[model samples]
Target chain A: MSFTTPTIDWAAFAPIIIVLGAGAAGILVEAFVKTPATRRTVQLALSLAALVASLGVIIAQWAALDGAGTVVMSGMATVDRQALAWMAILLVFGLLSMLLFASRDGGGAFTELGATAPGSVEEKLARRAGLQLTEVYPLALFAVGGMMLFTCVTDLVFLFVALEVFSLPLYLLVALARRRRYLSHEAALKYFILGAFSSAIYLFGVALVYGATTVTDVNMIGTAIVNLADADPLLLAGAVMIIVGFMFKIGAVPFHSWVPDAYQGAPTAVTAFMGAATKAAATAALVRVMFVAFAPLEWELSWLVWAVAIASMVYGTVVALVQTDIKRMLAYSGVAHAGFILVAFAGLEGEALTALPFYLLAYGLATIGAFAVVSQVRERAEDGGVGAEAVRLGQWAGLGKRSPLLAGSMALFLLSFAGIPMTAGFIGKFEAFSAAIAGGAWPLVLIAVLASAVAAFFYVRLIVLMFFTDAPEGAEETIAIEDGALTRVVIYVTAAAVLVLGILPSGVLNLFADASVLLVSVGG
Target chain B: MNPMNYVILAAILFSIGAAAVLLRRNAIVAFMGVELMLNAANLALVAFSRIHGELDGQIMAFFVMVVAAAEVVVGLAIIIAVFRARQTISLDEPAELKG
Candidate 1:
């Protein structure tokens, strides 16, 4: 082997560069800007600008994704189109979340039924009375940027850094809620500890892989392992360990214990961020490892992953069926969804790999929209104030009779979760299951379909609660909000996506096929 | 120098860490155990890097250490906050948010 100087594609890395600049700018704005409110505005604007730039880069790359666009950075990282696309999606998700958090109580019901038109003196006065905090935008963007980088990271070091870059801010995100501070605090603690443990396991796996194969560049490690497969015990141990760590992050059953508490306790906004983006990052990283690096040993590892997939599916769906609190139920549903997504990776077949990214997008959008709605609906207590507790199904008993639109949207999301035909979940589950079947994984595919049915029961139950079940006595029937434009937009767009993708999944499926399947013929 | 020895030591250390994560109740203790596992991994990585005469793995190990350090600070701070909130660090007792 000869030593060579590394080359970088700065243009390809434009999104990341822009985000880092925004993060720096955010810190500056935070320090110099006097009011937290004013600083939040500037910081959020900067973050949104960074996300917009990320979107632009993604579009540019999508226009030119014919070849594997590798911007090798000192032989450490690459700026590829697949990663850029995932990042672009992440930034857009971040932007939408920021929009929801941007408005002053626009989501809270005090801001809802309490005011008239903005031009009215009453509305203006109410606005002047309270200062809303929306500083989560910059932190969210930095986290999004880190996740974007996480998807594209070609080297081991970049991978770990990207993981932490996103993880740290997320801990704070959990603790930011106003109503359920204790729950948030506990959730943050559990999440932080579990996350740290998983990170450690991941690093340990990397170390063993390094020790056995004596290489760290994933491409190099894969090659060395292929040659040493019969001789290297360390490589085998390391591979299995790394897979376990990733399985935990993606909430594969048995390692999924923290998800429900974390999701339920964290603010709904933060839950959406973790529910969607974390899965994307974990799935992307796993694909890069499984398909790109260790594609050779697919036959052996596929079984382990398949077992996990089946377990996750059954566990998530069955547990969700019995949950009363909406958030905890959604958490279980997220777990089951992770299983469905992982089922797409039960083998190294090209079709299966393609389904992986598409499944993430479908699941991300659905979970994000669901959380957005959860954040929107408010219930007023006896003292005459509204908050998140108003989001319960009991309070939502007469929702259809009150605000038919919100009820209908909630119904669509529920139907989507059930993978009903004409929803994105349907398409996502179909493609993932079909991919697994194509890979000759019939039994696991059957189990996945069965688990979907189980999940459907809970999803349908929610629909019944929204449409058929009568409101409990003393419960609020109307959905009140302080601000809700962004939530409504997210709800409708995600619902429409579910329907469109369900009705005609072929287009997105084809796009997924065209996208790099995280399989880059490494040893060639 | 026996490579098997290095690999064995890493494995033993990792198992100890895993046991700690599973058996310990204190969040901070579990965190420390996780750190030990991480260090064991770093040791294996460097050892393997030296054996292979490769700089790539060594470089990667450096990055892993940086991430591990960051995770510790943030993780410890979060644990401290929770302790203050609930006056307990035992994972078994923090069912206040459980489903």
Candidate 2:
């Protein structure tokens, strides 16, 4: 017998490895060289550096991506343009989160809260009174690194491990806010327990999958299933188990109850991370599993996804309408968006998978920015209330008069959510819908459109409040722009990109097409 | 030892461990269950390698063991911190998250 060792591609793994390495180093720096100022700076600087390094690597990968991704390191991972796109989006979200969380509690434009708020002496004084969320950068970055690794993982073992790495950090971040420990802690514990349960279920599913195929490599499983093309109960069981795990993680319908609670109870910055990056990773990994390994079983998983997607859409929209709290409404709105993303999944057999990447980018940016605005508006602890109570749509009354920039930004995102022409959100949904329609999924498209219309009501409701209502006496409290320059930069860029993509969507459409072409999933 | 017998025993143990991880709420028990599951997998992988006269499965098993150790260590620390702060290991009691 002869044995040959498969070469590992350390270079291909560089982008993710860098982030993980930084996370470890940042903890070490804080542990040994500990001072409050140093603690903040070390965590903040390390996080920014890690993401920046990942971005630089992403640029290099993009430049070289003409037939670029090769299965590296004995086929442990496949580095492709899609992975690059997902990582890029995650990194960008991390950067934006850092910026949005930039300010400290002292009176500054980028305050931890109401720093740049409107109103006279009273509102400013009130802004000064709100509770502060400190050292959010390290936690946010830790989660980002987890997400970036999740996108690049090629095999199932690596996939599950990476998922937990990203997920655990976020569970902790939710509880770590200096103020409002009770709300935040409770949220964290709930998220941790359930998230861990979901992960264990996911891992067991992976185990079953390994048992069925007698193989752990994902692409190899794809090869095995296609080669056999028969009803191996074990294999089917494995596939079913794996699909259930993925389904739960993405918060599709039955598994979605955890989402709103986690989103509403978590500190806003943590909420932003979970809303944007975690969902992106979980969805991206799902596409990798179903579309990549189980493409042969499309006959099976497709219908299941369709049912979940439809339920998610209708449930999300209906529940969102009656919610009085702004964050809760957005939480339901998120559930609806999850349905839209899955609608793209329902067409997994063809050009529809292309929409997955672009749709995630669009949805993530808009959602992150929306949450950022929410974080900024909620009142501080010193303001003599629990963590910010500013969610009522009417509370946004007269926002246009006071903090025009914040209101305008919120309006832009809301319109994008409404899929108004010319914003990235519209382009994203349009592309996904077009692909679904191309796949001859008329009913799904029609339902998706109707749900979009229903969902639009609440998104526009906030707009009317922002533009019409007189800023409730306290509504003029401007959101302190956090000092993290990157968060604001990301928000501005995404908000602007929303408009730009809306205008010349063809460029993005072309990118989506080319990117979609490379997906080795069911259709392409 | 018969390699096939080892494989079957490992599979049984793996299932038992997975069930424990799923059905139990005590953090330490869950951690022990995870450890059991990983060790069972390692045993199976090693047994298969001995039967097939291969090294790949053995190496993979070794890696799994290493990761299991790391996971148990970190996971236990986090659970401990949570328990210390809240003074309870009953996982069902932390249900304040509903909006």
Candidate 3:
């Protein structure tokens, strides 16, 4: 038999191509560019340019789209408005994260040498030589590209590939934090083990699903379900396992053990990037899977969503209340927000399509901006030099008196996280809850509303510490705020976005509504 | 022997791998368990591909093998880093960050 190669639509794939291509080129730059300073500048410029160009291409694709979307790569992926919207969000996060990564002279967050033992002679030498792990720029691009693919891939196997493409880079990046090397390494190890285990489970699930359906394409799985007289146990089991894997990535409960550790242990810049973009990518994929592949199984599968959503909301909010560490608290808060996003999936209504993306955008902005604020506040070392991040809750006391701008922005982000009116988080929560209500999941929405109130307590407590309380005696000189220009840009942009989206959400809400439709390919 | 038996064997092996991952403390052993689980999935894929007279599952198995190899490189690099820092690769060794 003669085999013919499938034709590729190059333009449709250009966005992912551009980012991953830049990532590949970055490896060459790392080798050839002799000077560390010059290499960093080149890598930073390359990463930013690639992210911006990809964003441009996605917008062009959005405007020029003729129909719902086309199945590109011979059914390996789809490029619908839904995928385009997610891609745009991921790109924006990528751009902001690249800026954060480049801030503080490209060496603020990451270690001087990843392979060197912390506090060892080699580490000291690397630091003195001004070596930066500028390779983080390339790795971030790969992750962005992988996340973009994760949102759009049509086949289950391709989805698995996309999952790894993004996750591997994150695993490496999580370990490169400059401070708390032991915690960073531990977090990386745990993340890698759990992440790899989950993906293996997901792959097995894909295999079983392929066996039952005789196809791997998600839309084709739906068609296969329609044709079958009864639901196969294999298909049911496989679908649940696949979702379990997605939940692991989304940092929901029972599978969320790694969330706090990784978030706290990772460099704040990496945490900001992962917290925002990873959730958007995983949520987008889950939405596609639920709407397209598992629509027929909704009645059977939704209880799982309900159970996880409730657990994440209750557990996340409760645990976050007592946490003293800023990063750990935010990590738990992220778990609760994950629950809020899942509430939209309750009724499986079309409205969830719009609600989920908007919620993620709002939540992501607040997350990145808040983390940027965290990155700015440093602990004062013994000799009066700037030390590692000041992460304890008490350390933030009287921040408003010292750095009013940073403190004010931090308060705004916390208010937004608490879903107070006049911020994006408020609008995001309203949309999500309304979508759940429309889907006949009012009970879940009620629980979610209560969780939001409880969550507000912790968020507001942080605000009180920042603005209302005074620094304890002899602690006045403990906190040092770094004036990183790039980080300030991120904070300003995300804060402005949070306020604008909250006040004038109509345009964005309409945009999300219009782009909510998923492209369903048939017959493989 | 029936071809379906291969699928059964794969499932049993997957269970064993999962159990090892959850119970074992040694980082390398747990990592080995992950590799076992991946290969078990590959076994099932190849078996299913044969049963269906289709090439998709076999092609997928090849992709899984490649991805798994890449995973090994990263995983071992991380494991080595942890070992170098802490002098042991026990999963329970590091407890610096706690709630």
Would candidate 1 be rated incorrect, acceptable, medium or high by CAPRI criteria?
A: acceptable
What's the i-RMS for candidate 2 in angstroms?
7.5
Q: List ranges where model 2 is wrong by over 4 Å.
A: A1-6, A105-142, A348-350, A380-389, A392-394, A471-490, A518-524, B1-95
Summarize candidate 1's per-residue lDDT along A379-457 as a digit string, tens digits: 5544556545454556656667766777787777777778887777777777788888877888888888888887899
Please give the CA lDDT of all the candidate structures.
Answer: 0.73, 0.70, 0.92
Off by over 4 Å in 1: A1-5, A106-135, A229-231, A477-483, A504-506, A517-524, B1-3
Q: Sort the candidates on DockQ, descending order.
A: 3, 1, 2
Q: Score residue A24 of candidate 3 by CA lDDT.
A: 97
List model 3 lDDT by residue over B12-96, tens digit each. 9999999999899999999999999999999999998998899999999999999999999999999999998989999877877
RMSD of each: 5.3, 6.0, 1.1
The alpha-carbon lDDT assigned to residue A437 of candidate 3 equals 92
- In DockQ, how does model 3 score against the reference complex? 0.79
Better of 1 and 2 by lDDT: 1
For each candidate in turn, the TM-score is 0.91, 0.84, 0.99
Candidate 1: residue A424 lDDT (0-100): 78
Residue B9 of model 2: what lDDT? 86
Clashing pairs in 3: none
